[model samples]
Target: MPQAAPMLRVENLAVTRGGLPVLEGLGFTLEAGQALVLRGPNGIGKTTLLRTLAGLQPALAGTISMPPETMAYAAHADGLKSTLTVTENLSFWAAVYGTGAIDAALDRMNLRQLADRPAHSLSAGQKRRLGLARLLVTGRPVWVLDEPTVSLDAASVALFAGAVRAHLAQGGAALMATHIDLGLSEATVLDLAPFKARPPELGGIAGSFDEAFA
Candidate 1:
């Protein structure tokens, strides 16, 4: 018998937003080639958990261990440069992540035709594809996606699912937060609300809409 490799491991994770604990002592492991979908009502900290895992937000307490250079995050904002052409944006991330498969990524997302167009000119769904294509270009083994299919059309959503399947085939892992079903057959689900708790003190900035939403 051999021990299994964990693409991502989270133990005793605790997170708070505006003095409310959204996650408490939540534990899970994502093995290579698997997908885990985080599900819950809005403001229950589904997005927060993803951001925390991406190291974008501070986790009050927890241990998150993952492989080096193997994790990629697809934030809700898409993170595309409005002024740059789609190809330019992908090229930039490729160099940053040191991945040499720009063409393959473009092809995967079906964005080759729009490669020369400015990101701002792309439709919402196209932008989502572009955002996802970045991960393909990076070739990271672990993906943390927040509302990945928010604006995608039916075909595009199916396309995204295909990309996910391909990624898994390559032994990658994914943790995604989505309201709609992603139609992924092999995915497992984790509900964040059960572990939800309010933070102790939201402080002066607590009155903002972010806290209100939380």
Candidate 2:
């Protein structure tokens, strides 16, 4: 049988922060039900790559081919409203994404117990769980996540791994930038160091040296 087209495709992709190139010549393709883990040291532009793919920032060069509505991005920050209750926060995203079934998301993230608590009142791990829960309600095929397991406990990490597996089983894909092992045996690993951008030649600088640092 013929293979299905990729859910996301990035070719010769380059990203910049503050007008300084950070990543370049990065290429990858993700198929349905697959996951790609981005591994690199700090300041190597993992988060920048994710943001570029999510359209929050523009790529300095190259191409990214993925349907706009098919992607859902979760950043390092939980992006929660401090005053809103857990359910209300999720409900808001659900409405925005045109997806229902908030209860199922809460249950999956083990967040049903804290459903009524204000986001500011939750612990770090709780907040991360809430952020992960938003992915469930997105109903989007591709997930672009940054440091998803940060501040999560061992049990919560396992819960998140299970959620990723479930999403793959349902034919969704994920591209994640994380430092820890998420226990995903089937996910492919992509090291960002190979794509780290070289310093620009003289007279090619786009901004001041201080501004070029990401």
State model 2's lDDT.
Answer: 0.91
Model 2: runs farther than 4 Å from truth?
Answer: 202-214
State how far residue 41 of model 2 sits from its true place (Å).
0.8
lDDT by residue (tens digit), candidate 2, 140-190: 999999999999999999999999999988889999999999999999999
The alpha-carbon lDDT assigned to residue 13 of candidate 1 equals 88
Measured against the true structure, the TM-scores of the candidates, in listed sequence, are: 0.89, 0.93
Distance from true location, Cα of 145 in model 2, Å:
0.3
Question: Per-residue alpha-carbon lDDT of model 1 for 1-214, expressed as tens digits?
Answer: 1246798999988776664556777899999889999999988888878888888767767898887777899988889999999999999999999876699999989999999999999999999999999999887899999999998998899899999989988888899999888889889999887776644463211223355444
lDDT of 2 at 35: 94
Clashes of each: 8, 0
Model 2, C-alpha of 186: deviation from truth (Å): 0.4
